[model samples]
Structures are given as structure tokens and as C-alpha cells.
Target: MSSNTIIEVKNLNLTKGRKKILDIEYFSLEEGEAVALIGPNGAGKSTFMQVLMLLQRPTGGELFFKGDRVDWKKPIAYRRRMAMVFQEPLLLDTTVYHNVASGLKLRGFKVDTIPARVNEWLGRLGISHLAGRQARYLSGGESQRVSLARALVLEPEVLFLDEPFVALDVPTRAALTAELARILRDTRITSVFVTHDYSEVPLLAETVTVLEQGRIIQQASPREIMTRPTSRTVASLVGVENMIPGKVVGTQDGVVFVQAGPHRIKSIAAVPVGTNVLILLRPEDIRIFKGVSRHGDNSFGGKVSELLPHNYLYKAVIDCGFPLIAFVNPEQVMGGEVLADNEITVQFSPDKVHLIGQYD
Candidate 1:
């Protein structure tokens, strides 16, 4: 553990009747470090946050803050040290200024200094002009800004963001994310963010903890988590489109060769020869062309079984012994021949295909 550790949870578990809600063994957050906690619905993401924020008492084990054991009886004191922003903008029926200063007033800030703190935070959040506007009249983006200003004006020791941008539109969400990133960088506050959006992890956190079925599965940096997930379950979460089962044939020239689905492909994994492995190929890594292209380190022929539009790109599923999804852009798709049931080729470099642990 680092000397700068601010929050630690040891063997924490939450059970209700015969069901387990959260079964975290051990977790720690360093001072001024921001981390993203991500999981699907009912994966204990919110439940675990409640435990850390002292909103929900754990059924077993203990929680520590700054090396001191948390006292359950003193909820108010601990709560005052941390602030939480939920998905919905839970603002009052008053003006933006009042909503931002409400928490300060309840926390017993001096009346004389309330205006200064509120105005400063509103300006910082880019909502100073909207301070006099009523909460009900504000747009979704403005309401969220008010909510953020309300949270930051308190200068709490910890900040918890629970899907704070889920309700905003695309452009608005992007703007809010940039603004939040700036605030986090400037304040260097200890924060724990929870969101189902994996892409948002890189903006706010260096570390990401993934949960599944109430169990803490993996903890690593966003890049590491995306490039090399620990398990097949985690690979799926990180957008691994192709998980081909393969058998290690031999090793040569720092590359381990594997026989997968009637084809031999090379990978950069260090697994021993004769072992079984899973080749994780993301759609973005595979290039699809109408005709066979033997240019890549690994190439295979597959029928273009499906073509689905994914925003600006097309998701094409090719049947090359097994289903292989390749990201086809406007330039990659054949000229005016973008249709299913056509013959195509999928090619990927040996280094592009990530190999995880051996498959059972």
C-alpha cells in the first residue's frame, strides 16, 4: 500500500438474505488519484460505491479512510467529506445560485462567504451566466453543470461520479467530459467514478476496476484493460469481436504460431507450444476486402454474411470457418458493392491479434 492511500476496503461483502450483492476482497484508492469503476447493471457497481461513500453499511469486513477505521455512527461527518453526483440532475426548485450554495449552507458555511464560493464555482463550471436562471427552465446540459458546480463548491475530500453524463446528448456529454477532466486535473481531488461507458474511463481515470456478478474481476489501466483483458469474460466487455480458439503449434522468431479454425496464424503471446489459446481480434484490427489480400501476416477467406451500420463505420461479419467481425469504413468497403452474402477476405497482422491465457 502506498503512503498516500486515502481509502481502503478490506474483505468487504454485502449480502441480502441468500443473495450476494457485493463480494469485493480488497481495494484501495490513493490520495488525489481518480479511478473508474465499471460494470453492467446489477454488477454491484453502485452498491459498492454506496459502501465506500458510507451510504450503505457493509454486511462484513471493514472500511478505512486515511488509515483510520470508519465509524458507522458518524455518517454526517464522513458524508461531509465526500460528494456524490448521480445520473439525474437532482436540483431544487430555486435559482442555479441557490442550488449550488445549498450544500454549503447545510454544511454550515458562513453566510458572508457563501456568495464568493458559489460565484467562483459557477464561473469555473462555465455556468456563471445561468446563475440567476431557475432550475426548471435550464436545459439538460445546464442542469448538469449546476449539479457539478454544487458538488465542487464544497471542496470535499472525495468525489463520486455515478453515470453523471448518461443523460446528456452526444455533444453535451463530450463538452461536460472535457470540462470535468479540466476540473479534475486542476483540483487533483481523490475521486471514484462509476459508468457503464467504457470509453469514458480514459478521460477521468488511470485505473479501472471491472466487476461482474458482484465480484471484482479485474483492475488495471484503461489501455492495458482494453489491449489485454485478463479473461474471456473481460475480453467481451472490452469489445473483442473475435475470440478464436486455437492450439499452439510452435514458436519461431519471437512469435508463437497457432492453428485456429483450419488456418495457421501467428501471435505475440509467450504461451508454451502445444497449449490451447484464444485469439482476440477486435473488429478495428481486421481489414475486410472484397477480394483476397495476402498482404497481412495472416489472411483468410470468408463470406460476407452480414453488414450492419455502426455509426460512421460498418460492422461486417465474415464466415471464415467461424464468424469474424471486421470494421469496414467507407474506403474499406468495395465500391458500390456493400452487401451481404458476398465473398470477402479478412486480414490482420500477427501483432494485432492479442492472445489471452490458455483456453480450457
Candidate 2:
């Protein structure tokens, strides 16, 4: 690797029982940067992570670390520089301190250094108070923290996490995420995380790779992947609720006009004239007004068809010829008039509408 590139996979392919599990043409990770591998279940995210962890060998292609070719026969030597955490905590039936210190013991660290290192990691993971607890008796969140301490205590150059927070409650998940972010920032360790949750991408990664059917469909920054997805599958994976089929009418100046059903929408994106396209809009970007709004370029009269409550907002599905979901504050809907069949206008700025090229 150059000073910038830490891990590089070129034309990697993996197979199990004659079925190809992963086919990545080109992928690279930069030093000290965090990347998220996101996709639906059975998309090969876990299989790819396993390959990187040296638990599985690729059926074809090349993998390099720090510009050195990986030697499969000597995998154990190379694997010491990396550590991984899985969905569940697999703690040994021993004290929390010994579990965190196990890796060091295997590496033949001095007895005097193991306790200090274990204590350091426990404090770092905010589980110092649980150091004396039996590993088998810890709660889910505490066990995950101990598992994290065990991984981080080794000071590996690269870290792999496969849905590490999947089993924790919401508050515990958020707190662990914040703590992991701080540790990664301070340590500057190159990291790869696999997750199916779209919301976790924005919090954990600077770059995201969208995988589908064992292939990388799109890779970009979180903002770019969300706003300018290259394919409809990528758009749906990022929680884009509005993906209306449209035909690009024309482009004038710097704007593109598209026709969806009977509605005309102005887009900041440029597409060739007469080309079929998919217009992607997040529910949070759509605004609802009781009457006409002077701000947005595309506006249509609609009737509120349904109001569904999500975690912290109300998702209102409106029938404006074309259906759309708008997220509004729950407090704003309190004691408000029932929206059923109520006349309303759904509007969105031209910049918020993304035009994705039609993929066959």
C-alpha cells in the first residue's frame, strides 16, 4: 500500500460448494478511515468479512495489507494485526479481566503487563466496574462491552465488526456507538463494519459500500450514497421511500425537468432528454403544507391517506396522484384536526429530488 492505502482487494472472488459468494472487482481501504459494508440479509456481507478475517480463503484474486501480499499458509502471523467482533459476545467462562486479557496471554505478554492492559481496555469501554464479574453472568450490553474490550486491548491495526450492536436495546446501542466512535477517532485504526441497518451508516462510516447479491453496486460517501444513488436497489437500501418512475423531458440551464405520472418535477440533477429515470426522495425531505407554499418548485394538491408513527415522527402517506411519505414532528400533530381525506399540498425543493439512471 501507499501511505494512504491500508487494505486492497482486487478482483476478489469467493465460492462455497461451487456457488460464488462474493465477486468484488476492485475495493480499497484507506489508512485510519472507517468504511461500512451495508446490504440486505444474505447479501454476502458476512462472508466477505470472514474472508478478510482470514477465516476463509478466496477462491480467486488478490488481497494485500500495507502493500504486502497476504500469505494464506501463514495466516495466523498476519491475523494478529487485526481483530474482529461478531453479533453476539462469545466470552469465556471466566472473570471479565481474564477474558479481556486472553489475547495477550496467548501472545506471551509478561504477567505484569496483562493486568494493566486489561484494566486499560475495561476503562476505555466504560466497563471498569464489571472487571470482576463472571463473564457468563453479564447482561447483554455488559457482555458486548467486555467483548469490545477484549478486541481493543490487542491494539490491532485493523478492526472488523459484524453487527456488533444488533442485540442491544436502543439506548445501549446508541451509547456503544458513541463510545466506539470516540475510540476509533483517538486510535486512528482502519476499520470495516458490516451492518444491515441503514441508519447506522451515517453514524459509523465516512465511506459506504452498498452490496447486493454478492456484488458491490455502489460505493460513495454516506451523503452521496443517500442523495445520488446510482441504482434503484441502492436507493431503497438507504431508506429512500419515494422512487417514482419518470421520463426526463429536457434539461435547460442547469436543471432537468421530469414527468412522473401527471406531475412535472424540477430536478437539480442532469439527465439526458427522453431517458427513463427514477426520482428518489427521502420521506424527511418532503414537506406538507395546509395550503400553497411559495418556497418549493414542485407542488401538488393531495389528500392525506394514512398517518403512521415511526420512532420519533409521524409518516404521513399522501395521495397526490402519486403517493409520498412525509415525516412530521409528532407534537405538531397532537390535537390537530384529523388528516383523513383532508386537502393538503405536498412540496419539495428541486435540489432535494434525485434522478437515478434507469438500470435496465
Candidate 3:
């Protein structure tokens, strides 16, 4: 392990009830870096986190902490250095202050030192005013804040969040995510975050690890993971909405041109000519045009097959050779002009298109 590596794993394997769960060859977490562990249902995301948190021992392989093999003889000494918050608050049936202070008190902190630490975390998580309130009486948002205070009060060297925001309302989740982001930045605590919601990954993690079927498929920065998926399965897992079958026709000046049905798409990627590929387009990157601008390589005329109001924008399916899903802000471009069966041009920047792995 490198000097900065905080948690490292090698040949890790886990089995439960004769079923294999995790088979990680190698993985590492650097100090002060946050990683988003994400996958679809039954991808063993939780099993992997549980192993790293030391809540579940692996069936085989070694787990290293700060370059030293973990000493299982003294489990509390290692476990105490980390904290975990789950989807539910899991608060004790007690006062908010007592709930936050419970961990420290159990760990043998001096009675005099507990209040300052508990109160400090309460203030940091914005639940200080509810310090005296009973845990059960608090709202979901407040209860989660109390839970966070409970975990943060430990001053843990590493933090594990297992979908901690999953149970909160949308507004509450957003607010708490922002708050957590600030705290993570300030503290620089090594963190492992697991969430099924891909949207939440950007809010918490700097690196994104994509796992699937008891194995890690890819690990990279969020942009790279979204823009350049390692396989078609990964593309589907990451919500790649528009995947058009195409073949690479030519390459020049750092761009590859492909023929998707009648449309010729240009993407800023590298691939050998004549290579079969899937052109991945994000819904947000699709641009709607009222008329044929005829700009260049990325424009295609398609009929508006359907349109639906999605929040402040419109979700549209345009029959442009392929049924392409597009999002347009009606308030900005065509407030009253959009309707089904109307002819419109669908276009996107050449740079927005991404090519997946070479086709079989």
C-alpha cells in the first residue's frame, strides 16, 4: 500500500449460505478521498461496504488498514476509528443529546468532555436547537440530522454512509446532502458512500466505483464513468438513455464519425475505423430546434412523437430514425410552439456524444 492509502483490500471474497457475494481482486481508498460505491439491485454494494466497515468479515482474503494488516484480536480499536450511518436514522429511544452522546459515553470518554463534543456536532449538523427533544418526536429531517450528529460526534477517521439520505424527503435530502458535502470538505475524512440513486453520487463522492454481480466493473471520476462506460451493461446501469447502434466510419482531429441509421453522428472519441459502436447520448444534451438549422454533422429532422411536462422542462420522444428522448426547456425556446406530430429538428453538440466499447 502507498503511504497515503488508508484502506486496501486484496483477494477479498465473501460467501453466505453457499452463495458467493464479493470477489474483489484489489481495491484501495486514499486518505481524505470519498468514493461512491454504486450498482444496481443485487450488485453486492452493501456486502462490499459491510466488509470494509468490518461489520462483516470476508470469507477469504486480507483487509489492510493504513498499510498494516488488520489486527482482529483488537477489533474495537479498529472499529472505533470508523463510523457508519444507514438509510434509517436508527436513533435510540432517548433525548437527541443523549442519542448523540451515547457512542462517546459507551467508548469511555470522560463525562466532562462528552457535552462539548456532542453539542459541537449537534451545532454542526444544525440540530443543536433540538438537543433536548426526544428522538422519536423529531421529524424525518430532524431525526436524520440527529443521526448524523451521533456519527460525527465520534470524530471518526473514516465514515461510511449506506444510503443515509434514502429515507428523507427530496428537499430534506438535498439540504442534508449539501450540508454533508461541506462537512466532508472541512474534515477531509476518508469516506465510503453507497447509494442506489446515481444523482446522489455527485453530491458526496469525488471518485465513482461501479460494481456489478460481485465484481467491480469500473472505477473513475464521475464524468468519465458517465461519459465513457466500460461496457453496454455499465451504460444501462448508469442510465444511458439514448443508445443508438452505429459503426465507426472515420476518425480525424480527435473525433470519430459514425453512421447511426440515416444519421451521421460525430463524437470526440478514439476507435478504429469500421468498428461497431453504440452512440450514447444523455437526455439533457439533446437540443430541440423549431426549424431545420442545418448546422452540420449532428443535426437530424424528426417528428415530435410525444411530449410531456417534466418539472420545468419537457420530456419529448422524437422519431428521428430512432426514437430519441430529449429534454427541452419550453420556457426558454418554444413556450407554446411545441406539440405532437409537429416537425422539428433534433441536434446535439458533437462533443456530447460518447462511444461505448467495441462491438462484438
Better-scoring candidate (lDDT), 1 or 2: 1
Structure candidate 3, residue pairs in collision: none
Q: Which lDDT values do the candidates have, in the order given? A: 0.88, 0.87, 0.87
Candidate 3 per-residue lDDT, tens place, 1-360, comes to 789998999999998898889999999999999999988889999999998988888889999998889866666778988998998998999999999999999889999999999989988988888999999999999988888888889988789999998888889988999999999989998899998778777768899998888899999998888877878767777777888889999988998989988878889987889888888888898877776557566988998889888767888888988899888787633665556887888778988888875462
Better of 1 and 2 by TM-score: 2
Listed in order, each prediction's TM-score against the native is 0.95, 0.96, 0.96
Candidate 1 ranges beyond 4 A from true positions: 357-360
Arranged by lDDT with the best first, the candidates are 1, 2, 3
Greater-TM-score candidate between 1 and 3: 3
Report lDDT (Cα) of residue 212, candidate 3: 86
Question: Weakest 10 consecutive residues, lDDT, candidate 2?
Answer: 331-340
For candidate 2, lDDT tens digit of each residue in 102-177? 9889877898888888999999888899888899999999999999999999888899999999999999998999
Tell me the tens digit of each residue's lDDT in model 1 across 19-96: 999998999999898999987678999999999999999899889988888998887788888998999999999999
lDDT comparison, 1 vs 3, better candidate: 1
lDDT of 1 at 234: 80
Worst 10 residues of 3 by lDDT: 330-339
